[model samples]
Target chain A: MTVQTPGLIATPKPRHAPALRLRRLQEISLGYLLLAPALIILIVFEILPIFYGVGISMCDWKTGAALGVEGWQRWIAPCVSFIGIDSYTRAFTDPAMWHSLLVTATYSLISVPVQLGLGLLLAYLLFQKVRGQQAFRVLFFMPYITSTVASAAIWAFLYNPDKGLINSILTRFGVPEIRWLSDTTGIFQVLLKPAGVDLPSGLEGPSIAMLALIIYTTWVFVGYDITIFLAGLGNIPAELYDAAKVDGASGWTLFRHITFPLLSPTTFFLLMLTVIGTFKAFNHIWVMTQGGPGDATTTASIYIFKQLFQLNRYGYSAALSFILFFIILILTVFQNRFAGRRVVYD
Target chain B: MNRDKLKSQLTNLGIHAILISGALFMVFPFAWMILGSLQTFHETTLGTFLPEQPMWSNYYDAIVAMNGAKPCVFDPAAPLDILTREKGCMIVRYFFNTMVMGLGTVLGVLTTGTLAGYAFARMNFPGRETLFKLLLATMMIPGELTLIPNYVFMVWFPTPESWIATALNLPNAEPHNWIDTYYALIIPWIATVFSIFLFRQFFRGIPNELFDAALLDGATHSRFLISVVLPLSKPVLITSALLTFLGSWNALMWPMLVTNSPEMRPIQVGLRSLITEAGTQTQLLLAGATVTIIPIIILYLFLQRWFVEGISNVGIRG
Candidate 1:
């Protein structure tokens, strides 16, 4: 750590090795001192809770109430019994857990694509020298910034079966009043019933209530995708587009050849994020549906919340959360292995 | 050339048409919220697009309901009395709580993030890289998993009142814990990995000559950070502050889980209760929703450039 620029400082270098060692010691202590606050908080809050969750998942803890036990003892021996891996096994075998997982998969599979497509289209349109582009971007991004609870409340009003705006618009077109939030019928079944098409239970898509949630989720998140896409679009060298145009390529041809390939990294990034986001999504769904209309919109997060908060099944809920973590991790790893290769990083 | 000009003008018009329509769809709910907040209950249930006569009273009723006060029986005698007495409304308290929480979170994050970020950026400590890598690894662990255990831990901590009452043998205070307190709300969230990462990157980009000069002047690390580095890092500070404030303000689920009393609830949870309790009072519900989000909307409008730029910049890099 000798000061190399001696002319600038005009101070004699501490060529004494002992002073340098003391300085090194001082630097180490200061570095640790600076890191102490953040490290302590992170370790206590973020890191320990994870191990604590694993421990809790292995217990038979219920409401965590004890007659005489108080303080930390409530979480330890004599109050909560140790039960190894029962909750994990239960989560695996429980039909409700599988159903919730199915609902989550259905919600993510449908909403992510819709969001990505709409976001890409909108970002592409905005990438052009359009007027009021900033206004458009701000308005679209409004939902992302606003509190989900407030927006979900508004959306719930707009989805009111008796007097909702959407149904009003539909009914104006001679369509019947649709139960936007309360309907539990699978949406594909509802849509295809008129076509005399019958599908089995497992093949049924997300319920109408779930479809409403998917739409709401798309509305909240599409703006974020658009912003990210716009950034990605900006990163593309303008020379590529100009070269393509010089070679007599039309706008569509240029986008197809140059833009899409270059945007794959962003697309893949969004895809992974969207999948993870959909998995993590709970606020709007909880606010809007509460996994309601017969568990139609019960994504795994909702189910976990219900179990832990409403039903007081703490141990079981912890196990379910671990299952969810593993699912997200596996999905991410799988995507990296299969989809990450296709990304054009350069 | 004349035909091409006409065609390009048409294309421009078409793009405007599509974008404006999309933008309208994006903003339609906010428009509806504002309009609906001023509507009569009958108008809301009737799906009226606009109110025949604006009902400004709905906002007052929303505030009263949010406060968990007894619904005022409208009397012809004192038409304006209820509005005057409504100064102690819980929504006002919720706003205060939110402000305190937001400021506390911002202060905590800036302090911790800057200190740790400076260490990571400039200091030569053993295990520095390993510790930072560990911090980043925690970001991948989904928050939902930690939530349950965090709740348990929060519940396990003794409430200050009960602990004091027991120690002094003063009175039998109601048994509760840190679940509903500000500590539970603010502490766990302050040390975010993203903020630390953001500060670290920004600090690393600063020229080394400044640090060298500061060291020559015998300035301590804290002194250098406060005097030199912090002044140079205004943009990052604002970005982090705005983001942290926004996050704490809009938080719903964690706050909902932690706080049960209307006295402790932030606006989001309070607005949530309004939805359930004001079952048929759709107008009041919309009014409450509007009241809940209007502050955020105003803040967003004012600082939107930073919001948009900061988000996109972080999105691109992270």
Candidate 2:
């Protein structure tokens, strides 16, 4: 699930009294009337659109010119022919699309672990009693709350190859300037080139540009993950630590045996979320790199966006969205089946 | 005891070091942005930490540039009409536009969410359970998947006039221009499931006797909602309003897609064009970024207590 409405509500006494009362004409009418406005808006705007989306995905729909100026009329009376799996098959053969999948997969693969691991570590670091900790929390959480475009804009300037702070710092250490966001060279390939090591074509890791993007992503979300983890840490009864300490449990031992086990559920949740977040990350990527430096950072979301908005390929974008959807669904299911069981609930 | 004190001191020092450094790292981009905004265009990429001379004029120019083609100034010293004008003062206009969208979204969400949430929690309705479960299920659907279809619908959905005319056997009627309207920005965003879920959850906390008492007093459901539930749900209401306002305020993709004209565009759109369109104008771009984020930051700072509780509760409850 993208969002979990997990908090339970208190069960009222005399359950379904209102429900039973609804057998009367006025009561039933009131019930429907109460729900009608919200329901109508939701259905008309959100729910019906999903079915409409799937319908569009199946049809060989083009721009408004082809489908008529008032496109909803086309939906009323049919004109477009059903493409029938053509979009999906075309996606399979399309190299740019496949490479985009690779980039998105790699981004998720690299960024999720880094974010989760560092986020967990930071959570532990801040979980300790510290002076002015609240200030730190506010500062760290700012990025998560701030507009991604603004954050990405700031980072874009920071990642400037010629004058960015990172390169500036690197120069002070007597290192040559390194192209940050502009560098399409795979990090591994760049690292290995001095030693005359060459990897095969497909195994060349993610580009430096992607790494820059990932770093920005990590910075943006690390605080969020830390905040979540801090809450998780707070949930662990302090008595466990106290009792364990009384029994001669050291910091490492307590964390290893008690804290780690108890915190696994939150850790797993953040991990899954970070991965899902990476797949959907767009505003930052769009603002920062536009998935650029020669398609080195083009994630599936960005690719789908370009198709729909830039190329006017609505049907194709819809198809790509479904493909991405199935991938996420399958991955989520896979994680739930295999990895979710490892989470130790408190 | 001395050893333990020393160890604790060392640990606190270590914690402070790490926390402070991390905070600095997180905050540096914002600092840099503010600094960069004040620097001249050439000086921005000079790898300087501070501006040679701070220029507030970047902000003035950014406003003048984005405030539309009409020449305008926001100077308080300027005449009242200059401040009030909509033509060339697009930054102000977009700012107002975004605020309207934000307020409209919050109101729509609150009204609809409370109604739906109340009905679901307190009232009995046919298919209510199924509809709610369906709502929850729809939550899983990726919002990006709905983008194209929603866009198409907004652009070309049958106008109410056309539909009514057809039903009434009238000759002709024009379609509603759903896109680039206040409705476009505010309508689709109103049915926020999470907010509805939140209201419903909070509503469930109200004791059954409250409703029973209200019923005894001849209060209708709306009356109960207004007099009792709404008054009691200040925390949830504030949190919901803040979150919805923030979401709508920071909205980039949907509004960018729907609104094409300058006056209709929001701050986020203006901020994006400030970067993508006028790429080399780093000072103005950074200034635009700073200006764009300042409102939310101010709001967040003001509501820090509730916002923190909201954030923590969201994660903890999840």
How big is the positional error of residue B178 in model 1, measured in Å on the Cα after superposition? 2.7
Give me the TM-scores of chain B across the candidates: 0.84, 0.86
Itemize residue pairs with steric clashes in candidate 1.
none
lDDT for A12 (candidate 1): 40
Best by lDDT: 1
Report the Cα interface RMSD of each model, rounded to 1 decimal.
Answer: 2.5, 4.6
**Poorest 10 consecutive residues of model 2 chain B by lDDT?**
B79-88
List residue ranges in candidate 2 displaced over 4 A.
Answer: A1-35, A62-78, B68-71, B74-88, B118-130, B157-175, B204-228
* Residue B61 lDDT (model 2): 78
Write candidate 1's Cα lDDT for B1-318 as tens digits.
999899989988888888888888889999999899999888998888989999999998897787675554445686544333353456666777788889999999999999999999989899999999889767666566788667777887777778887777776566668877988888888899889987888798799899888887888788999899999998788888998999999988789878866667777777878888998888998898888788888998888877776666565555
Which residue pairs of candidate 2 clash?
A: B67-B88, B67-B90
What would the per-residue lDDT of candidate 1 be over residues A1-346, giving only the tens digit for each residue? 6545625333445576567678778989999999999999999898999888888888776535644555545555342577889899988899999999988998888998999999999999999969888889989899988888788878988998888888899999988788989988777888888899998987666788888888888888888899989988998999989988999997689889999999988898889888988887787888888899888989998999898778867678878988888888888889989999987877
